[model samples]
Structures are given as C-alpha cells and as structure tokens.
Target: MVKQERAVRTRQALVRAAAELFAAHGYARASLPAISARAGVSTGALHFHFPDKDALAGEVERVAARTVRELAGRCGRSEGSALGALVTATRQLAVTLAADPVTSAGFRLGGDPARRHRAGPLDWWQAWVRETVGRAEAAGELADGVCSEGAVVAVVAATAGFETLGSRDRDWLSRERMDRFWTLLLPCLASRPPTKEPRP
Candidate 1:
C-alpha cells in the first residue's frame, strides 16, 4: 500500500511539474529533463512513470479534462437556471485557468501547433459549453431569435481567447473582466435577467 501511494505521489508530482513547464514555455520548449528537475525526480524515475513527453502531456490533458468536467458539473447542479449556471461556470473557468497550471497548460497544449492533434482541454470545454447553452435554450433562457449554435460558438471563442490571453497576462482571466464580459453579453443572450447578479 505504501509503495502504491508513493508511486501515485511521484506520478502526480511529475504531472504537475510537466504542466508548470508546459504552461510557462509551451509544449515544444518544455523538456523532459526540466520536468524531472522541477519534480525533483531523476530522469529514470520520470521515465518509469511516463515513457516520454507525449505521455506526460497526455496525462496532463486528462487531468485537466477531469477538472473541467467537475467544475462544469458542480456549477450546473448548484445554479437555479441554465444560463445562470453558464455565467457562473465561465467566471469560475477564468479563475481556474489563472490559478491552475495543469489546466492552463492543457488549454495551451490544445492550441499549440507543436503538439500533435488531439481532443485536448479546449475541445472538452467547447462541448460542455455547447451542451449547457443547449440546455439554456430548452429552458427558454435565451433571447428571441438567438440560436444555440451561434451562442455556443460565441461563448467558446470568447473563453478560448481569454484562456490564450490569460497565459500571458492573468488579468485577462480576472473576475472583474469576466463580469464585464457577461454584463455586456447577458442582455443580448438571455430572455430574462439572471436570477443572481454577478458576484462581487
């Protein structure tokens, strides 16, 4: 049991270290040696846990996808309205991107030209946003003439942009900036005002 626990901790550390480097320097620039150094593990240990940089990046993406799913599920269950939940989720996502290196790295990896094509964090987020927006439409939360597909595109594009920019300047993911975005968007997107105002 102790051995298993230690192995798990080692894997976690390596993943975190790789994520930090990937987030800071992109996939092409982050090296396995640097990742191992950051994790305080030997190269042999890192190889024992992950065969290569691609494997390590895959694990980071998986962990990041799980984190996004949990965040979306939590916000969906807690909010009174679907649109309200979406607003809350977007705000939380920005905060998450700013605070969590794994998630931020996953987003960057998804868009990185150097990385091979895969359904990375952005893909997962886009799907979630689409589903949530569809639910809001079904719930009659969307304004008249507003189509679900268009809303999905808009939300996904905006959030993806924020994630990309947030990589350079965290202020792009700030609560105040997110609130401002929603304030301008909500009036046109919603049938009625959100039940809860944006959190201060």
Candidate 2:
C-alpha cells in the first residue's frame, strides 16, 4: 500500500514539475532531466512513469482537459440562465489558465505542431462554447436575431485572444480585463443583460 501511494505521489510530482517546465519552455525544448530534477525524482522514475516527453505532455493535457471539463460541468449545472453560465465559465477558464501552469502548458501542447494526432485545449474549449451557446439559444437566453454560430465565434475568439495574449502579459487574463470583455459582449448576445454587477 505504501509503495503504491508513493508511486502516485511521485507521478503527481513529475506531472507538476513537467507542467512548470513546459510552461516556461515549449514542449520541444523542455528536457526530461530538467523535469526529473525539478520534481526531485530520479530520471529512472520519470521513465518508469512516462515512456517519453510526448507521453508526459499527453498526461498533462489529459489532466488539463479533466479540470476544464469539471469547470464547464459546474457551469452547466447552474440554475441561472445558460448565457449567464457561459459567461461564468469563460471567466473561470481565464482565471485557471493564468493561475495553473499545467492548464497553460496543456493548451500550448495541444497547439504544438509536432503533436498532430493530439487534440489541444483550444479544441476542447471551442466545443464547450458551441454546446453552451447552443443551449443558451434554445433556452431563449440569446438576443433576437443573434446567431448561435456568431455568439460562439465571438466568445471563443475573445477568450482565445486573451489566452494567447496572456502568454506574454498575464494582465491579459486579469479579472478586470475579462469583466470588460463580458461587459461589452453580454448585452449583444443575451436577451437580457445580467442585473447584478459582474464578478471579477
């Protein structure tokens, strides 16, 4: 039991370390030795857990996807309007990307040209926006004449732009910036704008 638990901890440590390195240096540039050293684990342990750097990156992507899916699920379960939920989810995602190295790295890995077969974090987000916007449209949360595709494109594009810009300047992902984005956009997309002051 102790051995299994230690193994789990070691794996978690490796993933966290890899995420930090991958975030700092792109996937192609991040070395296994550096990751293992950062994790305080031997290179042998890293190889035992992951066959290669791609595999390690793949695990990070999986963890990131799960985190994002959970966030989206929580938003979906909200009792408020679908449009409200979508806005909330977008804010939450931006915050996560800014705060969590793993998530940020996962997005980078997903977009990496070398990983042709792997779906990136952006793809997952785009799909979520499509579904969430579709729900809002069906629920009559969208403004009259607002096309679902248009709404999806707008939201996804803005959020993605934030994510890309945040890579250079984290201020791009700030709550104030995101609030400004929603403030400008919600009225155009939603049938009725939120009455409550927007959360940061």
Candidate 3:
C-alpha cells in the first residue's frame, strides 16, 4: 500500500507538470525532459511511469475525465432544474479549467483525433452528460423522445466550441455568455409544448 501510494504521488506530479507545460506550449512543443524537470523526477523515472509523450497525454486525459466524474457526482444532488444544473456545471467547468490549464489543454489537443490523447476525457464527459440528462428526463423535466445521447453530444460539442472561442476572443467568455448558452440548451433538451399554426 505504501509503495502504491508513493507511485501514485509521483504520477500525479508528472501529470500536473506535463499538463501545465502542454497547455502553455501546446503538446507538440512540450518535451518529456522539461516535464520531468518540472515534476522533479529523473528522466528514467518519468519513462518508467510513462513510456512516451503520448502515454503522458493519456494520463492527463484520464485525470481530467476523473475530475469531471467527481464534479458530476456532486452536481447530481441538486434539486434544481436540469437547465439550472447544466448551467451550473458549465460555469464550474470554466472556473475549474482556468485553474488547471493542463487539463483544459488536453481537451483542446484532443479536438483532433489525429493528435493528443484523443478520447479519454471526452468519453467520460459524454457518459456523464448522458446520465445527467437521463436523470432529468426521469424526473419529468424533459420531454419524450428527448434523446440523452444527442444531448450529451450537443453539450460536449458546445463546450469545446466555447473553449475554442474563448481562447480566441477573451472578451466573450463571460457569465452572460454562460446564461445565453443555458437559454439555447434548455429548449433543445426540454419538452417543447405543442404549437398551434394556421392551415396553409
């Protein structure tokens, strides 16, 4: 147990260091040796834990996914509406992202399946979003035929798009935009009332 704990600590440090460097310089620009030095680990030890840079990226992706799972677990308890919970999660994600650029970078890098740790964190988010939407529907907060899978994909895509936009347009990433996102998302996920129209 003691040995396992020590190994876990070492891996965690490596992920933290690598994440920061990758976020700052991007995955292609980051070198393993720099990551090793930043994490205070010898190159050999770093190699032992992660055989290559891609492996390191995988670990970072896993860590980001795990963080989302933990956050979703907490958010599940809210008695708030589905739209409200979704908004809350988005805001928290932005804050959490600002604190840990490495994890955030993982998502950006994974935006290309041909590059980076492609699916780790993203898969986790997809599952969690599906589950959350499923729960909301069960509580009668969503309409019939409201596909959880579709909602999950939409939310993830929307988030990735916003992050991309935020990276480009710093001024647009705001609390107000978050609210606007909620406005757009709720109707998509909500049960639309039957509409009346004049006969053509």
lDDT (Cα, 0-100) at 164 in candidate 1: 88
Worst 10 residues of 2 by lDDT: 191-200
In angstroms, how far off is 98's CA in candidate 1?
0.7
Per TM-score, the best of the predicted structures is 1
Q: What C-alpha lDDT, on a 0 to 100 scale, does residue 187 get in candidate 2? A: 82
Q: Model 2: per-residue lDDT, tens digit, 1-200?
A: 99999999999999999999887887778899999999999999999999999899989989888889898888767636678778888898999999988888887777666665587677898899998889888877889999999989998888778877998899999988988888888888878765443344
Provide the lDDT at 58 for model 1: 95
Off by over 4 Å in 3: 1-9, 113-118, 143-150, 168-173, 187-200
Please provide, for model 3 over 1-200, each residue's C-alpha lDDT reduced to its tens digit, 9 standing for 90 to 100: 99999899899899989988877677788899999999999999899999999998888888887787666656555525554566567666655665666557666667644463467666677666777777777777676777777877788888777666766565345666766776666766677421321011
lDDT of each: 0.90, 0.85, 0.71
Q: Candidate 2: deviation at residue 28, Å? A: 0.9
| Cand. 2 TM to true fold | 0.93
Best candidate per lDDT, number? 1
Error of 2 at 123 (Å): 1.7
Alpha carbon deviation, residue 126, candidate 1 (Å): 0.6
Report lDDT (Cα) of residue 171, candidate 1: 93
Better of 1 and 3 by TM-score: 1
